[model samples]
Target: MSAGDYPQVGQGWAFPPHWVRPVPGPASVVTDHGEERIERSLQVLLRTLTGSRVMRLGFGSGVDRYVFEPRTPDACYRLADDVRRALLLGEPRVIVDSVEAVAAEDADDRVDVVIAYRIDRHRRPNSLVVPFYLAGAR
Candidate 1:
């Protein structure tokens, strides 16, 4: 089945919320669908901190815990585990294949989180690289 055919992974307002204005009409909020929608949802989930949302106190990945910690192997492994767990709980449409946290080659303060996944029953696999910044890491 196509991505659009999956009801569980339907359309939603795009993340990093922005407005789009048509040539002959008013501005409207941008929307996302299918795989793009899921990717954006994952970005949101990773960016949010646990307990930050009043209604959904457990709705985030809590990766902020690593922001000030050293970018060691142990830290990377923990971060990967946190991401995998968060995605499993927050997003039901994806089956995670792997999550890896590795230091960025070009930047000392950046860690690249590589996530490999497949949506529900589809055979095609997808990947996303999210950069985690360690602003105060030593």
Candidate 2:
């Protein structure tokens, strides 16, 4: 089914809310619908650090903790697991298929976290890759 078929997915203000001007109209904040909305939500969930939210102290991923660690196999595995767990706890709109952290080809301090998921009520699977930079890596 097309994205329009999934009205239940709804709409949300665009992440990092940007403004766009329409023809002969004032600028308006961007919005996202259907799958795009879900993807943005996932991005926000993953980027947020646990305990950073004042009212929802437990509402974020723990992957930020790995920023200072070496990107070894063990650290990668742990980061991936943390991402999976965070999604399971935070996003009710998706079923996480897998999460993996792979080193960037030309950057020793960077890891690309690949998240495979299926949106609820959507047939096709989707994946997102979030780049993670290890601050302490040399």
Candidate 3:
């Protein structure tokens, strides 16, 4: 989704100016750490990653918001499985990497304020399995 369409992901607020947000579903099954908890963890991560200038945040508006992420690659498949379970009111940024990829095209790669809940370790395998795997492509 375009940056202007999503306010939570790329709004002119707490987020970095260059941190473009991704639009995707939330985590599931393997990501047992409630979505709120996941967001909280990511918020902490955003505050901790001292090298990135942009951070992708998955924070939703309210309780109805199904924004979450998997901390490990092994959990991404399961996270995808939960896509049906989570009800997205609007498109939410998928992960911090997406923002990086999109921003890279514009010549901005200083993501020192990322808010990713976790990274999927098996992303390479999924990228190969999935036909249009643009999630981790550089």
Runs with alpha carbons beyond 4 Å of true place in candidate 1: 1-5, 135-138
After superposition of all CA atoms, the RMSD between model 2 and the true structure is 2.0
TM-scores for every predicted model: 0.88, 0.88, 0.18
Model 3 residue runs over 4 Å out of place are 1-33, 49-97, 100-138
The local distance difference test score of each candidate is 0.88, 0.87, 0.27
Worst 10 residues of 3 by lDDT: 125-134
| True-structure Cα RMSD, model 1 | 2.2
Candidate 1 residue pairs that clash: none
Best by lDDT: 1
Using TM-score as the measure, the top candidate is 1
Worst lDDT run of 10 residues, candidate 2, spans 1-10
**What TM-score does candidate 1 get on C-alpha atoms?**
0.88
